[model samples]
Target: MLYVKIHQLSERKFKITQIAKELKISRPTVYKYLGMTYEEVKQLLEDPHRKARKLDPYRDWIIAWLEEYPHLSAAQIRDWLLERYPDMEVGESTVRSYVRELREIYQIEKKNIVRQYEAVPEQPMGKQLQVDWGETKQKTINKKEVKLYFIAFVLAHSRLKYMEWQNRPFTTRDAIRCHENAFQYYGGRTEEIVYDQDHLITVSENAGQLLLTTEFQSYVNERKFKIHLCRKADPESKGMIENVVKYIKGNFADSRVFSNIDDWNKRALQWLERTGNYHVHQTTKKRPAEVFLVEKQHLKPVSSLLSFESNHEQSITRNVGKDNTVRFKSNRYSVPLGTYNSATDNQVYIKIKTGKRQTLEIRKQLEGEIIAEHLISLEKGKLIQNRNHTRDRSKGIEEYKEHLISRFKDQEQGRTYLNEICLKYARYRRDQLAIIHRVIQEDPGWIDEALTKCLKEKLYSANDFRDMVQYFKNLKVAPVRNKMNDSKGPKHAKGMIVTTRSLDAYTSILGGAAQ
Candidate 1:
């Protein structure tokens, strides 16, 4: 183009008149093509050559080397080129010009590549909001390590933003809570929320389709908000929030110090009110608060807050043996003796709440009757064993020796037998002989049943037998009566009777007893 040639000539130190005479055109015409005023041409002729150098054949090699080693200096590159071509001597200035040209070409190539991506236009204001998280560290009240997470929210149209920090680790609960807080603060709800692919909200991707987490989906559905997840590694898709992150980090967090997460968040809110809301955006030339006011008019009214409880319910079946002791998971838990009915063994439900940490809360019911309450064990992954199931195994052949001796104080034979039983059952401790004495005092009949059950079951301790006794006390001893008695027995039992009998027989045969 003529303009290109005019620019080249100007860079080459050609006078405007000289250029016009050479091209056989008027000076005004030459000036028009050059895109410069007469005064600009006068200044250009007085200056040094500003023409861009032509590309060299070896320039690509030089660029590749520099890219591989960015620290390489001009002198170093000159030496490298000389070594490659002994006869050629390239000046450092020429190498510099060539490097600059290569850099410009690369930038232009990158711009052209990015131009292929089309940006989606913004629609009505407050129709969508962007979400993200940033992190920093602070000292807690106890001077312990505390990593704080900042939830960043930005309006899609106006770029109005808010940030808050929490000490707890980010989870599905926190995600839902943050959305609730943002909606409350804004006094309205956007139809859609755009978010980076956070694992709490979006679980997995298959062929570019996002699978939302069950909890996250339910939360959004309750609020009537559509979710749009940006492509992975595409920060520009949510540029508003990304810019807000930079602004907050530089302006609010950089020089701030606080004793706790709450204090830091309070300070962040103050900073947002003072700086973020009032400042005019460089691109939009409107204050964020002003723009947000316009956008807020378009937003839908905020819905009533719904209960955001996590959904991690599970059914726990306690295994109770004939001895009346129940086994929870791997740990043995004991209830009152004759309190648990075998038919209701599986009715117990253990409610687990997983938040910043996992907590277990258990509820027990036997035929819909509340029998016992115990604190859930705090052991990490280890089942809590019931202490009531321990049984003493040292008692021997001299069963009622201590009792008989107590009645006849001077009976030597009874004393000897009592000592022998204590020695056998209590690891040769005379004190253990007193346990037999106490058992006789309570109920002598329980000793044999308890001992026989412990021995038969190979129970290791006296507590084990105790747990079994408790389990029996909680169970129903009465046999269930058949509701429909067959007068003809099974000769001609048909339909439901046959089906019920068959199912019961199959269950009994397979040892598959229901609760």
Candidate 2:
């Protein structure tokens, strides 16, 4: 009790002299107890004559939890104790000390997940660079949480790193810009670059044949750098940049409050200079900044920046859907009808223009002809279609109308009805004639009755004629179901069954409940 009290008092900002005076002990005794580790104090308490500790009853359960989980903290065990035994009284400090003693005595060391890696031979200076991406959740000035993303680049030989931050996820164009920025920062480019199979750079890796995104491919061709794309799920291929990503997240961005992306990046550059590059690397034992001085001489000279105006738009390949549409940013834009021919390849290229009001130009991948264009939609899941791309309705409408009129019993009356439809619904003549043709296909006899009813009732539209034919057809089928339910009570309807209860039965049930 005195030991715990001394420690507790010390924790409350009590000085050694104040602790000794309050505990009625000498300063030397306080110093000796404070110096003793939790294990040592536990040994003292383990003497045969020592009084039992408050947590002695729950010792076995704590051991079991620690052994099973191996990662349970002292505070978590205390929380579990309070949850299970609400009547129990124990301080957090006392539980912490007890948990520590139990762990040491049982040889139950907490373990961390460690990745297996083989030593990779270092590449020659200016030979290669590794790339990776990371994201972190940070707090804004209002204390609201916001997610920030960043791309990291590291020179393979010197381990010199550069990173750029964005408030939004990066596109292929943004990645190209970041690549240029990294080259400018390093004063040149390496002969080859290593990267994970990121979608911004690569579209697919079919049987090891890498298909690069159009924008990234163009950028690579312009810079003339070789690419080494890492296989899927293989972090060992680019572990150096992976380690840099972790180091930046843990050492720099973990506790930093984000104001904006630009400020975050500016501060990140300062961090790289003072600590990241200045610190001796664990493997090489040489500062990256110092090693980079020699590597910079070996790097290829950087060319002038490419004109953004010429390559301002990014082209992405998309498979045209059966509806002759391509999906971009959650919305589908129409191409010309028949663009989706399943017999041939249905691929098209979409060139996205990035500006105040963005637009997209779609072209046939093989022919490179401009097949369609539309202003990009801000709304999600929308189908933006151009009316001109729809099949022309005026091509064979007059002949098709005559064919539908030929199916009617009286061609003269059919002509009168069809002409009236054309006169009334000039815009929807094709649709009305199509519906009438469909009705003739469904039941030839019913169309005669429907036509007679329409001419008598002045129902000129095809929809009314279709509905009247459907009513006559349902009348023809009603007797069959009526015969099936003939033995049932009168309460049963044509399409539904209803059970009718008498009022006397309900009154009897209520009377029994009252009793």
Candidate 3:
């Protein structure tokens, strides 16, 4: 090819060294075909007079094996021949030499030679982000070896990267949370997010259409971002993120004394800000954070994005307000007072089933012992209290008020608080009474203080009373149903029933006594 290119120079007698220098080819090769035209060179190359080989007789059989197992090395084939037929022995050199010819004949060299692929076409700003996960084993954290699973997000155009590390495998919820965190880190999100055949998000692919896991679909639908799956078995499609994963392992995680997951993530974030984003990216030759400022404008801000939990299917545990309501669809949906009014267990878990239909039903999960359901609301943030749901609490309300007023009705401020709760809670007045009853059970000392604060703030729920108790206990404000305190966290349960055992039964067993 070099000789051909040099010979094509019109009217220029290019020196052999000049041809060699221009084409980066050896001088001897340039001189070998210096005066030859392209046609003469082609003819010379086509003149196939090859030397005979000792293993030529077995060449056909060797080619068959090569066809069956393309990965078989020359030495393996030579050993197989000697072992299979003791009568016929072939030297290693002869076998290797014959294999070279076979490779040329069968074009098998393409398999062994490292291929150079064209770089992916550059996407427009904010067009695409590639995501992938990497595993790091034998990582020592806090004096123990652990396996680390980390995900990487790379902005195709800017080469900006977001790396999040976890000590455990990512569930669907974890992946969604990481994506949200990544978008927040970058100040926005790309138009399309690219992914490998990740099992958490992908179900399968048919021809070219990508089939995503239902949870992931809801996640993307909520954010209004497009999802692009890399072609099956095509690592090159998401090569950028693959490179980023390697980069993170080598640069950030390797040779470092790993701490716990949270500490590792915190340090990783600092490392990104200090070095990864600020320093020059090798390919782009631009600081990612600096270029990100320009690219950020084109990306969609998270504030404008309304996604899954807001618009799509959501299952969460919410404390019912004091008005016989458990908030859902950003509206006050009615629950029976027995559920929200329980003195010992006022918490209820909600699961929204069969989404995207008119007249969706919020059926009670029987295992949860839920006793109420509501029609799905299209409008958001409205008070959708059912009048009849509160009516059942009316008789219970008057009875509880008479009992409470007889007890604290003497205290002037206490009387005012009870009166205000009765007016604000109405049919749910007994629900507020349950809160007072729980305060009396858990900490009678704090009941007056908690109720005084609750009444002043117009907070009329058991959770509010607990929040006040926690606040007074710790002298620091915390959530009412914080996961640390509650047996279950914010995530609602599905297909699982929660059962409790009394301490008194365990005490009886410990004392070796019959109940």
Better of 1 and 2 by lDDT: 2
lDDT of 3 by residue, 1-515 (tens): 34446566423776667766655455665566665777887786566675556786777888887876676667557645654565675665777777865764454532443534347787899999999988886447456778889989889888888888887778666788889888888888889999887777875676877766556677877788988888877877887887788667755665456767788888787667755676577778898888877888999888745445553345444555666677666787776543453333234456665646533233333233445656677889887655645543545665766665554423676667777767777775765676565455555545556666877788766567666875676664321322355667553333335677887888887986545
Tell me, by TM-score, which candidate is best: 2
CA lDDT, every model vs. true structure: 0.59, 0.79, 0.67
| Prediction 3 global C-alpha lDDT | 0.67
Top lDDT prediction, candidate number:
2
What shift in Å separates residue 386 of candidate 1 from its native position after superposition? 14
Which pairs in model 2 have colliding backbones?
none
lDDT of 2 by residue, 413-441 (tens): 88999999989999968766766776787
**Alpha-carbon error at 380 in model 2, in Å?**
9.2
Candidate closer to the true structure by lDDT (higher is better), 2 or 3: 2
- Listing every candidate in turn, what is its Cα RMSD in Å to the true structure after a full C-alpha superposition? 22.4, 26.3, 24.6
TM-score of every candidate relative to the true structure: 0.41, 0.50, 0.39
Candidate 1, 334: how far from true, in Å? 21
* Model 2 lDDT, full chain set: 0.79
